[model samples]
Target chain A: MTPVGAVATIGRLCRITRVTWLSELLEPGRMVSTAIQVGSQVFLTACLWTALYAHTEVSAGLQEHQAVGYAVLAVLASRLRPLSRDMAPDSFYRHMREGTILYWFLRPLPPHRYHLVRALGDQAHGLLWVLAGYGLCTTAGVVPLPDGRWTLPAFLVSMFLGQVIVYQLSLILDLLCFWTVANSNALHVSHFVQSLLSGAFAPLWFFPGWFTTANSFLPFQSTLHIPLSIYVGRIPVNRVPREVAVQAVWCLLLWLITRTLWKRAESRVAVQGG
Target chain B: MAGGTALRRSVYRLRLSWKLTSLNVRARLEYRVEFALGILAGILWQASVMVFATVLISRFPGLGGWSSGGVLLIASIRLLSHAVYGVLFANVNRLHAIVQEGKLEAFLLRPLPVYRQVVLHQFHINTFGDLAVAVTLFSLALRRLALEWTPFKIVFLCAAVVGGALIEAAVQTALSCAALRSPTATADWTGWLDHTLSTFGNYPLAILPGAVSGLLTFVLPVAFIAYLPAAVLTGTYEGTLVPREIALASPCAGVVLFLAARRLWNWNMRRYEGIGG
Candidate 1:
């Protein structure tokens, strides 16, 4: 493709994503629901870090200010992931169960492309909420900005790669719905594993050496912890390249995995008739 | 004759509920693999909570002067209360989904009390997973604390468990009632409430701001479910706005909440017009 054409394609995708996001934000009911959901998350993080920092001399290698950044960023970064990002009513399993997945097959577009487009919409919506949350927390003096000057751009790059990795991983879970009769339970288990290992609840620094060592091999850490740690300046600026490289590797591998699974899942799609 | 007839009718309703639950249980058993997978998932999910608590405490040896054992005991009580809630009130917890799908009409037409009907429509054995985790943690906490296990203490513990369960159910029922008015709003509210409990319930109440802590104690009163009970048992009840003596009233608090929630449920029921009646 020509460079101009490729740029145009990306711009169109961004426009579509923005439209979906604005519509959701404009809905009063949805806005209120989103506010409450986001508010509680920010409140929970504030309370947790406040409490943790209160009694402990220091947190998982984080000073008090860095602790607040880590806590706030972790919660927001969690919402930025694709597979589990907020505000989407139709999960892959739910659509498959109702046989509405066949509707996607009828479109001229490839299934992966269709899902990616829809995911962009959901991602935009979640990003808005995350920004709102961060703004609110900062204004309330509950969270602080990153101390390092170079951290902002590096954090953004890592966060972008981390989300790509999440999208691919979520695609794998979405593909499982084709073969498995019940995928909701699988989603539940994965959610627990993801939240625990990704350092959303607590930093990986606090875990036992063996656990953290083993976690280094998994992609979950790259999803939230690596990017978040970067934002809080826990990882040295020199080590940022290596951590980002790890995330990129996971993204490429999972993307290939999902591509293979999608082919198999395509053959298994049998629409039930009324 | 009237009293005897009323007594017989109540017994008959109770029998019907049991029969319905047995049938539901049998149907669940038919999906043996799914049922087994669900139980395993439940256990793993609950275990992850323990892992979080363990990791948190490993960093901070004693949370605000509360011993590690005291923290574990509090966490175990929260899980225990959750187990009881899951087993008994899981169906009621789905009221939002029911309201959304326009299925409430079927239950409203039933002869039995709507709450009883909702509670008995499904029997969840997956709660066993939560129960198992809770009991294991409770036992470990007991050993670490080395408290004397007298008959009176045993009885008090039993009552606390039941009371904690009741308190959780009352909160759940109240949320379900709230769903009847603004289904979507209350649904989100319930989710917020659940998030609040699971996230903050493990830590000492002293960590929260005074206003927020007071809300958890008096308004929502989730503290009575686990924190207060465990604190009373460990004799570490400090920094609470409420007096230490009131901590022992956890069981009584549960009963009061349940009765009050029942009243709220009935009031909401009268106003409910499911998706335009």
Candidate 2:
């Protein structure tokens, strides 16, 4: 596609993204439910971390504020993924089952680009939640601000790269539906693995040395841990570039693989609903 | 004579359900890979919980003053009962999808009870995996705890597991009442309830603020599932928001609360307007 055509496609996708917002705004009940869930989640997390720190001043090289901030940030960062999209009609498995997938192949837009567009839209919505939660936490003094001048900017850049890696990972996950059935349980198991390994559940610093070492070799830690650690000053500003570079490498590698899978998936497909 | 006939009829129904469940498992077995992965998923979920808890225990001196063994006991009991709930009543989570797919209409036409059909809808191959990890952890907890075990305590332990499962079933069943009409919204609440249970159910509620602890205990009855009962077993009632006598009777309270929730479900179920499209 030409650069101008690419811009036009992105613009149309952005409009569709607006419709997603409209759809969510249309459901006040779900919105309220989400607010309550996120509120209670942050509250409970802060309480747990506070309780855990009551005895020791520091454990695993993290102070009370840093640990609490990291845990609370993890809670907010977790909201970065749209919760119900997997069950929505746009999902690959759902589309395949409902026979609407043929439209993707028929449309002028390519399926791979469509997938990325929808994922970007979802991340936009999820980022709104994260922003709201972060604002609440910061204002309430539940999470502390980082000390360095460059911390916020560096964290933002690193977080962007991390989310790219995360999206690439999930793109591969959705593409798995081309060969397999629903497998919701397997999906859930993978989610658990990501949460545990990605430091969404707890900071990797709390984990033993060997576990963190093993995690460093995988793409998971860069997703949540590295960025949050930077925000909380666990990973010093001097080391920020190194961590972000690792994340960018993971992103490039995953992007290449998913692109290959998309090619294979399109070529392998035949009429199914007939 | 009437009671005997009723008993015989119930027995027959139970036997038929067993046959149906086995057939369901057989059908799932047709997808060999999904079946194996389903079981693996269950084991990994349970194992992940243990891993998180064990790592915390190793790092922290004690969680909110409860011994590591005490916390483990609560976690094991909660997971064991959760496995039981998965076996018997986890279909509540899927009720929305079932309604959306028009399965409920078919269920209503069947001779068997709609609830039973829904409960038996899936094989729940993962429950076997959850049960295995739960039992192993419970055994390890029992060995590590400093408390002495009596015959009464042992019996109460068994009752506690069943009661805990009942409480969770009741909560989800009551939530499912709304699923008949507005399934999309109901799914969020059930999902949140599951999230709450998985995150908070393992730890002692005392770690939380007093009001939050009360919310889990009285408003939601999550504490009744395992923490209160486990507290009674070990006599570690220090931070429990409720009285000693109340905690001791948690299992019994679970029974009462579940019965009340059932009554609520039936009342709401009557108003169910299916959205079978």
Candidate 3:
């Protein structure tokens, strides 16, 4: 494909994806349900953090406000990242049974790129939720601003890289469907491991030293933990560049891995009986 | 004659369900590696929250003046409830797909009752993993809390486990029944409700703001499933927003909710015409 043609395809895909997401958001019942769901989660996390801070002698090296900020921001940020449902065993089984996946091969553009665009669109609603949560938390005085000057800019950049890394990781899992006929259990197991290792459930700092030390060797910590830690000023401003660099490195590594896997996965698509 | 026939039918269905469940487990075991991975994954998944609870309790003594053991008891009970719910009620999750694809015809064509067919469609083999962990943790918490054990407390403990499971199954059944009326409405909301109950149910209900605590207790009744029951056993019943007598009546509440859910399910089910049927 020519450069201009590729650009046009991307633009069209983005528009289609965005329109679908917009319609989904506009659905009144779904909108209300999401608000209630997200509101409860934020409120629950705030309650949990408040209790933790209240009884502890040491505030886990964070001020009460900083800890609250991290708790709420982490929950809000979790919304923006979604892994592919293709790896889920049930979906793969249906696609295979119905031969729906053949449609992907017939598409003009690669299916992976199409999926990436859709993933971005999926996050559109989550982005709105995050904005609303930030407003609510701020107005309610439930969370405080970060201590450092560079926190906001650094957090934004790092978070983008974090999402990319998460997307690449999920794509790699999805590509595993080429090997295994049933991967539903694998998806469930992987999701649980990734969410915990990513520190979405709790800050990695609270974990024992050996766990955090082992986590440093892996890429999961760089996804949600590093970005949120930066946002909450847990990582010093001087160390901001280092943390962001770590995320970028993980993103690039996962990107390369996903690309290689996609090639292999395409070749291995065993077409069964007519 | 009518009551005897009903009893006989129930016995037959229970025996058939046991056989079918065994066969399902055997089929899953054929893929040994995958089966093992699923169980391991489930254990790890359930363990995550326990680990989180550990970290929190380590930092703070306890929420609502309950000890670490008290908190762990609550967590363990919740897991046990979830395990039972998975075994007995998780088929409701599949109701969305069954209705969406008009697969209800399969159940309708079966010789068995539609509810029985749907409920026993697939036994959740993964929940055994959760059950094992919950039992182990509950034992540990029991040892740690060191409550004076009477025959009554032991019996209440048994009742709480069964009651907690009933409450969860009731909620899930009601949601599934509601899904029959509006396909898109209940599935997402059911998931949200489950997540809210399990996650928020971990902490002491006393820590939640008054309105939220009341909502959990009186409206959703998630409090009865784990928190209030645990509070009663731990002698910390005073901390709960609701009365101690209400906490003690959790078993009765569970029975009442279960019957209500059944009535709702039967009423809605009678009116259900398959989406694309």
Candidate 4:
């Protein structure tokens, strides 16, 4: 895309994000203050992380870089709220099954595009909170801009992909409510599993030999660990393409899974109604 | 004669509570797959502690002159305390929601003390997984250390674990009383405080700065639950005055905190406006 197009895209994204976020802002000052508090809490967590690194005799480099990486990962991990049973997509799917989707179905825009727009809007709201957290960490010196030239670009790409992957996974999990009334347990279990596999609690390197090897081939690493590693420049510049490719593959796979699930879900709804 | 009758009534109530708890476990078991999955999830949660230990140990052979075995002792104590929190006092964490939904008034109308009823209301059987993991880790650390086991040391460890549970329960109860004060604040603050304390409390107090360490030890008394007791058991501090003080005072801290918490809970009861009242 051209620079102008890229700017335009970002502007559109920002507009979507701001509008969604503003919906919750009945009192803008209170919302901003709450956001700041959230940011400060993230800063305190980063401080604790730094202290742990300094005290523990971990390798100096890992202690410094990976500690910050894990700190950011921890902040992000805490933001995931499991979809409660009441909040599950059953009602939405039921509407779709009952042909109420025809309301939107009759609209000029495709249903898939509508869903994408809605999700993007939601994600933009979430991204604002994340930025608040990032700002807090930066202010506290818990996160420093990379002295190395490659750090900025690498971190931006990795974080973007991480967000995409996480959103996709959540969407996939939410889709389960289309078939099952009791998807709460599945939601909780999937989140717990994701946290474990994604190296939110610890680096993937610390995982047991077989699990670590397996995780390397999976998209779970790309969610937090791979991006973090790239942010810290643990993986060299030459290896950037392979890392991005791995993340891209996971994204593609998730997209395919989501497409198949949506189609099957629609068919199930049709059959049940008939 | 009155005291004797009261004692008998207490015993009977305890028995009834135990039966009720067992029934809950059986009810949970009806969903056999979910029960199994919950147990597995609990184990995985426990295993994350070890994974963290592995990472720390791999990076630093020792933390502050204490070896990995010493750290394991602390971690095990923490796990046991957490198990108690999960199994017995887990409902304390839910008190905020109950208060908001006006459910507490139902219990208040009953003859039983609200606190006792609350404690006995729910049981998370998955806590057994944490208990098992903690015991296994403690034993492994003991073997690795090659410390000659004495009856005195075993007694001390048991006292420490019991005391730790009491302290954890007390803190949770104290936080629960916030539900009576500001319903929404209870959820926001208590959850944040619980997570913050539990995660940060796992590491040795020495890892933190002096002020923070003082805050954990005195302000929150989290150090009493895991660090101080583990320090005594592991003999990590040979000649420190702080260690001596902690060894003597940590268990007593639990008793004091529980008494204070009990008082606070009763005070809050009077202020409670039942649902729709």
Best by lDDT: 2
For candidate 2, write residues B1-277 as lDDT tens digits.
9999999999998899899999999998877877888888888878877776766677887688887788889999999999999999888788888887778888878897777888989868989989998998898788778778899898988889999999888888888888888877777788888878877888899898788888899899889999998999989998898999888788887678778877887787667676866
* DockQ of predictions, in order shown: 0.46, 0.58, 0.55, 0.26
Model 2 stretches with alpha carbons more than 4 Å out: A1-7, A270-274
User: What would the per-residue lDDT of candidate 1 be over residues B97-145, giving only the tens digit for each residue?
Assistant: 6777676788888777888877887777768888999888888777778
Say which prediction, candidate 1 or candidate 4, comes out ahead on TM-score: 1
- What order do candidates take by TM-score, descending? 2, 3, 1, 4
Q: Between which residue pairs do clashes occur in model 3?
A: A89-A184
**Residue by residue across A1-274, what tens digits does model 3's lDDT show?**
9999989977898785675466655556656777788888888988887877775555668777777777788788777865233212124445544566666678887878776776777676578778888888989988776566788898889888888887787667667767765566787787777888888788777888889999998898887888888887788879988888888888888888988988887887764322
Best to worst by lDDT, what's the order? Answer: 2, 3, 1, 4
Candidate 1: Cα lDDT at A75: 79
Summarize candidate 4's per-residue lDDT along A106-176 as a digit string, tens digits.
66555555556656766665666667666756676776656488777987797778778887887786567
Relative to the unseen true structure, what is the C-alpha lDDT of residue A49 in candidate 4, on a scale of 0 to 100? 57
**What's the true lDDT of residue B107 in model 1?**
85
Instruction: Give TM-scores of the second chain, every candidate.
Output: 0.91, 0.96, 0.92, 0.91
lDDT by residue (tens digit), candidate 3, B1-277:
9999999988988899999889888888876666887888778778877777778666767776778889899999899888888888778766765676677877888787777778787777778788887887788788778889889888887888889888988888888886776655555677787788788777788888889888888889889898988988888976688788888888777888999988888888889887834
The candidates score, on chain A by TM-score, as follows 0.88, 0.94, 0.88, 0.75
Candidate 2 chain B lDDT trough over 10 residues, lowest sum: B268-277
